[model samples]
Target: MFDPQTQDQPLPQRLTRTLIIGAVVILVAIGGFTLIRDQFTEEEPPPPEPSAAPSPQATAQPTAPAGGDNLAQVDDWFPHSRTEFAEAGGVAADFAADVATIDYTRDDWDSHAERLGQWATDPYAVTLTTADGVAEGIWRALANDADAWTGSADVVEVTYFDPTSVTIVVQVQAEPDTGEDPTDLGEFSVDLTTNEGPGWRVDRAELLR
Candidate 1:
């Protein structure tokens, strides 16, 4: 029994079906949009902080020793001169003057001998047994000659020096006993030792040709 009137639904039923279909399509569109938006979006990371520079106070610095630069000041361990005779120049000058001031005619040979004795020591002292010995030798040599003889010694240089001792090189010039011209005795090297009591004294002498 198919009837043309029944085939055409009622208006209220058609309206309800239409409203339900439209609601389903809207829900589907909203779900798909939410999924797509979530897939494309991302959480951003935090920015990096700047590094700090080194400060002058953080650097290592060199410092001097506790004694306040020990190398800059001289220590007591080093030897020092306490007397004038310990000085090389003064001792050398005195020795040269004594050697050149000998006069055979001067009756005061004792004074010359005493001065020489004061300057000489050990081996040189043995060379001149007594102050008179030096005078006698020179007197014997100048007895026959009447010419005025003069002797002079020039300190050429100080070869070596220390707190205890010094060596000097000297050039000696003397007028001949024959009244001839002065002659050079070449150079002489003398070693002297320092004494606490007597100061500096000659221990050895050598004629360096």
Candidate 2:
């Protein structure tokens, strides 16, 4: 038969069980505190810093002016064709006459020199004569020695015509009173410009060959 008093656990065994229960309670409390701390804690945010604004865009530069060879602009400036052609032809004929016609006498030479001056631009006129006297020094020397010389020009064509300018090509012939064959002066090109005044004036003259 079992005794009721003896069925009770021993003192040492009861102390061991109490210690195990206390350890389990301590572990549960530590876990719950850790979870609560994590849930409530907040992280710090970074402070803002100042930034520079974008620089303003630079402006574009202007273009430079073109020097000479403004033919396109010149063409636009004068629109009339028939009038320009007539005026240019007349000017070219008068200039050719002035250049080819020279007399042995001083009076006739002076008149022709004056006409030539009127038919050329200031720059070219300077070439025909200086402030000292009429005609270049070399031409004056020839005219001084010669008894008689005559010349004429036949305008072959007026080409590269523009309102302000044109190219005059002509065949010039000359003869002396010494009774020699009429010399073929060959073809010459005269570039005339109307920029000086109302009438076309010679800017430059050159031999083609």
Candidate 3:
């Protein structure tokens, strides 16, 4: 009688077969991931930015003269004398003189001429006309020089500036001469800005014949 016996694989052979199958599955999964990598990737670069611009700044401005400058202007008015500057206005005498006067008093003769000269010469000549008594008559004393300048003198002065305008004020001394002397000692001056800058002129003068 033949016994029924089936052939069986060895334990070592079975183990080797299972290991080979697992290695094959792992290799397939790695290859699949490599192929699909691009689909899972991020390709967008960050948005570009614009550069910033520069900012602006403020500039500086100039200033005016001092309380003494007006006196300096008056000083400029002296010396030229009525004969030399009959046309310049705002002289004190335009109101009183029958004719603009002349500075004929001996240069050594003290008082009016000396006082006025001294006062007007000071850039800081704000001592009060009653200080020299000639600030008002300076132009009148010089108007009588008929040979140098002529015509009726009008010591007219108008506001050249205003505190409302740039915080500075200017007064125009406009005296046109009358070839003769004024009857009274007519002299006057007005106080305005202390300094002389920013288009402000001193007591500029002129003579006409």
Candidate 4:
């Protein structure tokens, strides 16, 4: 009975402990894998970006000129100039219409005003009768705005009733003030006889309004 070889071995305590520890490790691994399965299976794609739109406003353009407003303007030139005889020769008699147009700020505006004033009274009155004769001659010479100058006022026509007598056409516009529409204010026939000059200026105008 006492033979060591024949003895019932007391359960190997160390071996039993090792087997229990291995069983615990296997159970923990199984639980962790079960919990992680759902996370590994699910997938979500990212969102897309938005697009931009275009603008609205349009581009700009230039303006055009008025019709025969030019004729209306020239219609004013003849009589306006008739008031002054001194500077009324070359440029005045020629195609000098643009005074109100191209020459507005150019040329001697003072001269224009001075001559215009003289036509009414003052030192200019000395030659009143002669001036009137010249103006009348111009009035008789020119008929209407149409016969005078067109477009840019590049032309003019004058007719003499007698050697020293003439008739001219004139137009007036109440512009830069009341309205854009121009009015044919009046046409005039001036009479004058002067020893100083054949064509003096309009001493006085006979309103043919």
Q: Tell me the TM-score of each prediction against the true structure.
A: 0.45, 0.48, 0.24, 0.26
Per-prediction tally of clashes: 0, 0, 40, 23
lDDT of each: 0.63, 0.66, 0.38, 0.39
| Model 1: per-residue Cα lDDT at residue 209 | 70
Task: For model 2, state the Cα shift of residue 138 in Å.
Answer: 9.3
User: Which is superior by TM-score, 1 or 2?
Assistant: 2
Evaluated at residue 40, the lDDT of candidate 4 is 89
- Tens-digit per-residue lDDT, 116-198, candidate 4: 43433343344323434333233233323222211122212343334443434333221222233433333433433232353
lDDT for model 1: 0.63
Q: How good is model 3 by TM-score?
A: 0.24
What tens digits encode model 1's per-residue C-alpha lDDT throughout 119-167?
7775666565453343344435544554445666777887876777778
Worst 10 residues of 3 by lDDT: 164-173
Tell me the spans in candidate 1 whose CA falls farther than 4 Å from its real position.
1-87, 107-114, 130-148, 176-180, 196-198
Residue 138's lDDT within candidate 3 is 45
RMSD of 2: 13.3
Tens digit per residue, CA lDDT, model 3, 1-209: 55455345346877899999999999999989886886678588887887766666666665665666686577455443333233223332332231232343423233434343331323523331333433334444544543232213344444333331111121223333443442332233323222353222223222221
lDDT of 2: 0.66
Q: Candidate 2: which stretches are off by over 4 Å? A: 1-80, 107-113, 130-146, 178-180
TM-score of 4: 0.26
Candidates 1 and 3 compared by lDDT, better number: 1
Model 2 over residues 1-209: C-alpha lDDT tens digits?
98888887567978999999999999999999999998788565666776878898897887656745685466466544656766666666556545655566654555656667877898887666653332332235446435565666677787676656888787766565678775565676777887886767788766674
